[model samples]
Target: MADELLRASGLESGYGGVQVLWGADIAVAAGETVVLLGANGAGKTTLLRVLMGLMPAWRGTITLDGAAVTHETTDQRVRRGVAYMSELGVFPDMTIADNLRIGSRFAPRAARAAAIDALYARFPDLAGKRRSLAGSLSGGQRKMLGIAKALAGRPRLLVMDEPSAGLSPLYVAEVLAVLGRFRAEGLALLIAEQNVAFLDLADRVCTLERGRTVFTGTTAELHANDALERAYFGLT
Candidate 1:
């Protein structure tokens, strides 16, 4: 538990009186990459939103780095070292450099420029496209920009929603490879994904079904579970 960076228990939420998450529980340890896998419409994104504090949890407790943050605002969470990369992410109309600068806006004014520079160093392509509009980039390039933006804040925990969604296979590998580097750098990651490509990067896997966690274990355990494929696909 001391190694845990983020933990959510008894998570429940819904829209317009229709419940989607039912007492779901999950956690991500420091420097660990935990993959949330499930079929479409399985509440994967909803769960990520709840954990990121973008959406209120109806009944749950969320702790970030040993601090209770169930009620914390999204910005507050970011300030507390939690950064989220949404499915499509933000700042589509801006230039790559501008988007990264905005990510460091909450940091000390004197350090913001340096932070953006660091991100550019890490993502050289972004540096080359600094003046290019984010909307002009390819799908993979956009995903990279979003990730670079998240890292500009130097977060301890990175919550990404389907980073591989709608990406070409080559782009998916590139994106996942970038995430792999983050894990190596001791940044905890909680990624909601339907893509098995994420499996290779995960330290553990949690499969959700109808807002409930049906499986939580190492990659080996997940592979050994015969019911996983069926359960994930809603096959009888």
Candidate 2:
């Protein structure tokens, strides 16, 4: 992929002594949306952590825009246009506006203010509660705020972990619609999600089994493979 935005080859990482990823490889192209699917404990979160520099990779090379970034720090990666939204969502004690400020802190003062205003306009629910603590929001609203904060940074590649987790159907639809708008705007996304509903937003799907990437293909190709379904979803 000539326009590849991020690529990881032979990725291996774990906590303390336990190895979680075993030679996982994945790539994301500019303006593309790649969905990572796996069962619980399949190393999905670990992979995201390694990519974001939150954890060290025991062995592998990570490249962003064709430059090696395996050794970069989390802040370094963020400065290089990579923004991550963890599965846990936002800082509960912080006000909604404060959370957005934290995410957009890398921008200039003028740009940061503009970004916050844009976020408020984009997420009216959060706008109404901009002064409220994040802890006061519902699970779904927190998810929305997390995503909004990530976008406030103006990231080129937004890596999200389970953006739809614990949301009602209505919130799920709203989240999907928001993602669709970003996709249309040519933002690259690498999302780790359990929800199959995200297939509609993905340009490609990568499946992991036991910390290793076992499949990479289009949604149509994934739907046609019963073996992959069984391996990733434990379906018959």
Candidate 3:
């Protein structure tokens, strides 16, 4: 991964009393879409929080753009060009426009309005809902608004958690398509997703179990040995 934009080696984190990630090692190159797949409670969210600097790392290292970010503050990370859009709406009560504007907190005051306007121009649906409260948007729209808020800051890396979770079929497609669009924009992404079908959109897929990585491969390999996925996922 010579072009890798972000990397984590021996990454471990969790509640103060215990550890969840057991020396997990993963990387995502510039503009590449890398997906992390795992069963619920497998430390997926914890790992994301650690990468975003929301949770302190108990041990190990994290690098963004080849520079060590192990000690950077969460806002420092954001200013360094990594945007996180958690599955939970981080801006629930704010209007779509406000949410995007709020994301500009890390940006220079002079550029904030231009940034928001650019994102609004890109996501017309959100632009349409700019005046409406975010709580009033449909589930899918809320999800889109969250992503748009992150993108408004013009981040180099977009880390999304279950962007398609709990969405209707149409919204799911829209969300996944947004990820695809990220690739075209040359924005690297590290996504945590539950739907196996979306694996087709990823450049690489890592499957985790009990906080350990068990599989890292291409979609064709996964599709050919579907049983392996079932076995790894405990579908039986």
Clashing pairs in 1: none
Question: Which window of ten consecutive residues has the lowest lDDT sum in model 3?
Answer: 227-236
Candidate 3: C-alpha lDDT: 0.83
Q: Indicate the residue-level lDDT of 202 in model 2.
A: 93
After the best TM-score superposition of candidate 1, give how far the Cα of residue 40 lies from its true spot, in angstroms: 0.7
TM-score of candidate 3 to 2 decimals: 0.93
Residues 1-236 of candidate 1: C-alpha lDDT, one tens digit per residue: 56888899989998879999998899998889899998888899999998888889999899987899999898888998888999887588998878988888677788888889888888888899899999998888899999989888888888999999889999998998888887898988989998877989988999999999878898888766778955544455
- Sort by TM-score, best first: 2, 1, 3
- The per-prediction CA RMSD against the true structure, in angstroms, equals 1.8, 1.3, 1.9
TM-score of each: 0.95, 0.96, 0.93
How would you encode candidate 2's per-residue C-alpha lDDT over 86-148 as one tens digit per residue?
987689999999999999987767899998999899899999999999999998889889998
Q: Where does model 3 exceed 4 Å of error?
A: 224-227, 232-236
Q: Total clashes, candidate 1?
A: 0
Which prediction has more favorable lDDT, 1 or 2?
2
